[model samples]
Target: MSAADPTRSHGPGGVHPIARLPEEWEAYFEANGERAFRGAQVFRWIHQRGELDPAKMSDLSKAWRVRLSEEGLAPPFELVEVFRSRDGTRKLLLELVDGGRVECVLIPMSKESDEDDESPATSGSSAEPPTDRRRKMTLCISTQLGCAMGCVFCASGQAGLVRGLGAAEIAAQVLEARRHLDDGEVLSNLVYMGMGEPLHHYDETARSIRLLSHGEGAGFGLRRITVSTVGLVPGIRRLGEDFGGKVGLALSLHAPSDDVRQKIIPMNSRFGVRDLVQSLREYPLPRRRRITIEYTLISGVNDQPAHARALANLLRPLSVKINLIPMNVIDASSLAAPSDEGVERFRDLLVQAGYSCFLRRRRGDDVAAACGQLALAERLVRPSASS
Candidate 1:
């Protein structure tokens, strides 16, 4: 039942590490000629301890470690590139079993005036090291190889759809990140906003959520996770059906009207604002849970104060919060993020009209570490699907 049992019958190996449920741990051990009790101990080391190397597992017999290692039961990934931003942001480009690379980010929230020194943790530490200072940290992980939803403004879209990552691939990003933290520095938040639209890769994404939130995996509470999409109606509704309030939802509604939205976010044309709002009404949002509407303000395109008014009118009734993200510059080059004053004015209009609003500050712009930039570089270097 140990978490490290590769033969565990959780589900098909769809890329994620701990996609299978914890209950299946015992079954995996029994089949492996080990006592059922070994399952819990192994699972704890992998999940609770965040241990990757089998040799470091002191609780398990030496024979089991050799067996596991010889069988190549370790996580199927290698960190190929680590790009650090001046603003305490670290983006890791990981190469998968097939030699394709995906990007994952670790954004540290710190009040320190200077950037913290860079030090990647060793495999021996499964537990996150504690930091000297207290600051909220969030991990951004990818769910798919490349996105099918070709949002005109997003770099992840230009690469086209390659394939969806399995549950283990997605979970491994978080598990790998745990090694870098100081003690007591558990991940405060997780966002499916890295490269792919999570809703398009639904089942594996959902399974990954269950694994991360499960007590035997990352043990992150559901509230700490956030799934973002460019308005995939079917997936949005499915969240309500399956996860209910276990995780948070963020909708990428870049425009208040279909006309402007379709130009940037094509998915809006299929699921218009009306359908999106209607779906939200039916979503099983948790108590005090307000869905976040992500609006990336593009200069002179959708940044007009009038658009803000229209947005306020559109969302007046829904229990929602507005996250005004200024557009991050990328090669697509068709749009520009709104100025600070323009973003502030838009927020003022929302607040004056009785809506909660917050401006998402620009981070890692120098390193292209902002929202949709890393995916662009990764796409260029990642082997084509045919390769």
Candidate 2:
């Protein structure tokens, strides 16, 4: 089976050629009458070195190189454009093979007073080097071309879901983002928090994680990856079971009550908050790892003190850290974030209720890189390209 064949015929053991793990590659090589060690070598060459051109793989013989070339290795998408925010955030737009476009953002963890002051100071003078002070970057990637979950506040879901991305299309976003990293910076964390709800594409997302965290691949620690979902109960349970809860899970629990949630996040009508909380309780989280509860504070909506109290009460049974995001305004919606004073008051109520809570500082708002603000403008300007 030649790689150019669009059928994507699996190797001897049903491994997709491009997404094969090391052991699968070994099985393929053994089946193809080649040494098993060549599999590991090929895996490293493609993932570790990011060398997809089989002709550039110098370690293999001429005949083997020709065979591997037939079993192609290429990225499923291409980077189209990048919008850099004044605050050092970069929003990347990628075009898939079928002409579908998705957006991803790269956010650098800040070291200014806002972030540093939050951490308690040490007693003695710090001996850490200046290079250690460089902040780690988190790349937010998309699981689908567009979102199916019609969250009233998110721009990605405004048009409805286009299609789910393949595992290679998902992992390629990381490889493309890494090329734009600045000096003294390292890509540390990854959030499935851009463009689409990750749980909507569970199988492809799971395979992408394995490809990203494999020792021969991107090598990211499982702890460094966070998958955000809009309370997809079955997907949440499956993720916990598959990864043994080692991967970070972030729940988009925007409202305290089912009535309020259903209005903002339509998915709540399918899986209520009660069911979501039950799913969280069953997730086998590792010790000291807390599930992130993302509550977007919208003006005159879910930002009231009573709502905060209810949220705190609702989460009392589970181990969680609350991140209160003042919603970013979108052109498609008239909804807006609560006032600074109101947001602070809401956060205070949660804190007084004995829950660890934080008012998340909005990042990259100037360039439309904040939460729920991606893909809408691009979709408007490039409507023809999207089709």
Candidate 3:
């Protein structure tokens, strides 16, 4: 909000076509002396059909199409590379117009059906991706090139924040991901838990959500898109109010006690565990919707019988389900997931305490695409941390 700000997370000219809502696009066209409906047409082409190339928009007059091409309606990024895993997980490496890179992953999964599971989150892991045709693909998208929070165990934040992505760049990842889906796979849900603390750049993240959920554009159910954060309390409250508590909220509460959370999640030093749990009490979670608690079980660090019991006690008040992710191994990181037996014990403690818990299976590790493994800095760049 000041001249001293590093850089605002926004697209060129302050907004990109992919990021503009239908009305915003209509206004842009009206301001340009063109028919207002052209805005909706273009929006549908870009989001509803994943057509970003101006040349591909056949519905427009040839003259207008040429003008749009001249005005630059092409996609904002290029698909640099794709690494496909044996388990039907494809990791997309994208190069932005700024020369910064971000990775988005497509995991074709046999998720718990929407009718069967009432939670807003469509993310749940099975031993393998679906092969029998009853499947939905979850696209994990990034909000920044590198992370600022500097969590010790996460690769994304190991190097300090490089730059936050614009709303167009963030939402476009979903459109681009949809284009890459195989014939049998369908893109269903989205997760904002990719490369950065989404709430850190609140404006851009919120704008992207608005664009994605716009009925004429992507038209996604806000419930199907879960925005995961490391419990920035203010952001959590704003999300509940801004989205009417419809967009799913997942907390990366890796530990129940501040003493342990501080060691792993540096952001926890500012927002404590007790404060986070209390904030959810005010979160306008819809009926039958439960906030998801993501606990990363780092071996010998926070994985213990006592820790699990404390976690159950701490979260007993909130209507929540726990996802126990054995921390994914990353380059040069000595930390790791606990032994299988230890992971099972942690889940057992939560289950016995009458909370739903699931062990998240690691997908696409061979291609470095699992959780906490989306670090893509060719050379480390450390910017001064603000939060």
Report the C-alpha lDDT of model 2 over 224-250, residue by residue, as the tens digit: 788999999999999999999989999
lDDT of 1 by residue, 118-153 (tens): 222222234444444334567888887777898877
Off by over 4 Å in 3: 1-14, 110-133, 372-387
How does candidate 2 score on lDDT?
Answer: 0.78
Error of 3 at 243 (Å): 0.4
* Off by more than 4 A, model 2: 1-14, 110-131, 371-374, 380-387
Maximum-TM-score candidate: 3
Residue 177's lDDT in candidate 3: 83
Each candidate: RMSD: 5.3, 5.2, 5.1
Give the clash total for candidate 2.
Answer: 0
TM-score of 2: 0.88
Whole-model lDDT per candidate: 0.73, 0.78, 0.78
TM-score of each: 0.86, 0.88, 0.89
Residue 262, model 1, lDDT: 82
Clashing pairs in 3: none
- Candidate 3 TM-score to native: 0.89
Q: 119, model 1: CA deviation in Å? A: 26
